[model samples]
Every structure is written in C-alpha cells, then in structure tokens.
Target: MNNVKSLNKWANAHTYLPVDVLRMALGVFLFMKGVYFVSNIQYLVDLISPIEKIGGGMFLLHYIAPAHLVGGILIFFGLLTRWAIIAQLPILICAIIINFMGFMHHQNLLLALLSLGVCVFFLIYGSGKNSADYFFKMEQ
Candidate 1:
C-alpha cells in the first residue's frame, strides 16, 4: 500500500494545469482555423499564390487543404501534438510573410498575421502540460 501511494505521488508531482490549458487552447485554435479555411475556399486558393509565383497552382492547394483539415483535428485531440505543430508551421510562416509583411492593405491581413503568430508561439513552446509531449518527456 505504501509503495503504491509513493508511486502515485511521484507520477503526479510534476503535473501542471496551466500547461494543459495552453495545449487545449492551441488545439482548439488550430481546429477552428482549419474549419474556417475549409469553409472559405477562396482563402485557401489565395494561399497558393506564393506557390503560383514559383509555377505551382490549384493542384497544390487542393492537396494542402486536406492536410490542414486533418492536421487541425489532430492538434485538437492532443494526438501527435508535436507533429501537428510541425505540419502547421509552414502555413503559418507563409501567412506571416505574405499577409503580415504588407502584401495587402487591410484588416484581414492583420488578423491573419496575429492568429498565425499565436500558432507559431505554441509550436515553438508546445501545447503545454496535458500534452503527449509533456507526459512522454516525463517518462524519459
């Protein structure tokens, strides 16, 4: 009985609620963004503009959207947290560079950039406490 109690205490000693909140928030945001992109097909089409400049086109956009759609759901669930963050980084970076960098003059770009910035921060730091990464690292 004493050994069981000690093991339980050791397992939970490092658990933190704030980390879990952060992770959940990040996941929710990513999922929402994915849904928004899916609903706004034109927006995703515009996303391909950068690639278009390099000779790519709608084919790439179609492929990328499905990935984002799935990735968003993965992020929301805290499943494969690190990989989800990594997958979203490119899209976020492109948004920051293209929209936030003054490519367009309006509120839309600003909002997109702000959202992208949050995602970037989460990606760099992580989803927080209640995440696979956190517990996995604990085991290590």
Candidate 2:
C-alpha cells in the first residue's frame, strides 16, 4: 500500500499538465495579437506604404494576420502544433526582415527579432509536458 501511494505521488509530480497549460496560454496570446491586427485592417494597410517603398506591400501584412490567427488557434489547441509552429516561423522571420529593411533605424527590427525569438523557443521546445504531443506519444 505504501509503494502504491508513493508511485501515485511520483506520477503526479511528473505530469505534464503545466506544460500544456503554458502552451495553450502562449498560443491564445499570440492568436489574439494576430487577430487584433486582422481586426484593425487599417494599421496593416498603413504599414504597407512604408514597407512597400522598401519592396514589401500590404499583401505581406494581409498574409501575416491570417497566419497569426491560424497559428495561434492551432498551437492553443495542440492541434497540428508542429506544423503551426513551422508555418508561423516564416511569418515571424518576414516581420523581422521587413522591419529592418524599411525602418529608419533598428528599434522596430529589434522588437521583431525578440518576438521571433519567442516563437522560435516555442517551435523548438513545443508544449512539451501535457501537450497533445505528450499524450500522442504515450498513446502510441
């Protein structure tokens, strides 16, 4: 009986529940940020001008919003998480590139870089514990 109780306690300690919660939170946050950009189409449009003169256009902003929205949803729900992270990587990289190329200085570019770094962390580590990946692996 003592051994059984100890094993139960150990299992509880090793559970990945926290990781799943964190992953969902991050995904929801990113998703909402992206949705906000989409909802405020004008902001993206205005950004197009400055970026377009540097060879980018409104289309880029238009595309990014959807990617954020979709990626966020996927990551949040642990559905196709790997694919979602991979998809968003390009969008994040483009934001960094566009910011650097179009800005007068590097402040915005730095911000973009930071944002990209965060995304990269998620992409690499994933929602490790308690995530769909974890459950999926265990089931297999």
Candidate 3:
C-alpha cells in the first residue's frame, strides 16, 4: 500500500541537525554530572549510604559513577551512540524512581525528567547523520 511505502520512507529518512545538537547537549550534561560525582565522590558516597544499606543498592551505586563517565564520553563523540544511550538508560530510570520516591529535591525533579526525556529520545532515534557512529557506517 501507498501508506506502507510512505511509512517505510519516513523510517529510513536521515534525521536533521537538531537531533545531533540535542544529543550533544545531553552528552555534555551527563559528562558534567559524571565529573561532579567523581570530584565529589565522598559526598556521593555519603548521600547514597542509606540506600546502599539495601541489598544490591551498594553494587548499583558503585558502578553508576564510572558508567556515567564512560557513557557520557561515548555519547559526546557520537561513538557507539545507541549503546551509550542504552548504557545510560538504567541510571536515568533510577533517577526517575528516586525522584518519585521523594528522595530528590523538588527542584531536581524537573532536571531528572528532562534528562530522562533526552535519553529516551536518543535511545529511539540514535546519533543521526552527524555522529561518529554514522560516519563509521555502524548499523543503528
């Protein structure tokens, strides 16, 4: 059918520059967050100490900081963009969960939501045409 053909065409279409820009913005934000966590590791450890008391919570906290740093760097350069987004997804979801649990400050809720949105967007659309992933012709 014509509709099906049109849909296929749309699906295969290259994304515009805005998508890349948004991806870069998210990458920078996540990178900075990682840097902040690393620089203030003691503070992060202290803040999460209570949650770490729960089973498996300490394991999650231990890996999240480094994951953020590595994922952010990969995303910023558009290298392995989809995989980077996938790697970051769990952290973003955990942030949403924490926020909903009233563990986050009211002002931080909006930031968490926004970051989640960006992560979801990149997860779905990928790095677009401007990324190293695309340049290297890696399949999305």
Query: Which candidate number maximizes lDDT?
Result: 3
Tens digits of lDDT, candidate 3, 37-65: 88988866754554565667667766778
Candidate 2: segments with Cα more than 4 A from true spot: 1-22, 53-61, 104-111
- TM-score between model 3 and native: 0.80
lDDT to native, each model: 0.63, 0.69, 0.74
Q: Per-candidate TM vs. native?
A: 0.63, 0.67, 0.80
Error of 2 at 100 (Å): 2.2
Tens-digit lDDT string for candidate 1 (12-78)? 4654776556567666666776677779989877755655776656666665566567776666565
* Candidate 2 lDDT over residue span 1-140, tens digit each: 57634543454356577656766876886788788887888876754555567655655876778888898888887776767888888776766666656654476567557667766666555555456655675698
Q: In model 1, where is the ten-residue run with the lowest total lDDT?
A: 4-13
* Cα RMSD for candidates in order: 7.4, 8.1, 4.4
lDDT of 3: 0.74
Greater TM-score among 1 and 3 belongs to 3
- Total clashing pairs for each candidate: 2, 0, 0
- The TM-score leader among the candidates is 3
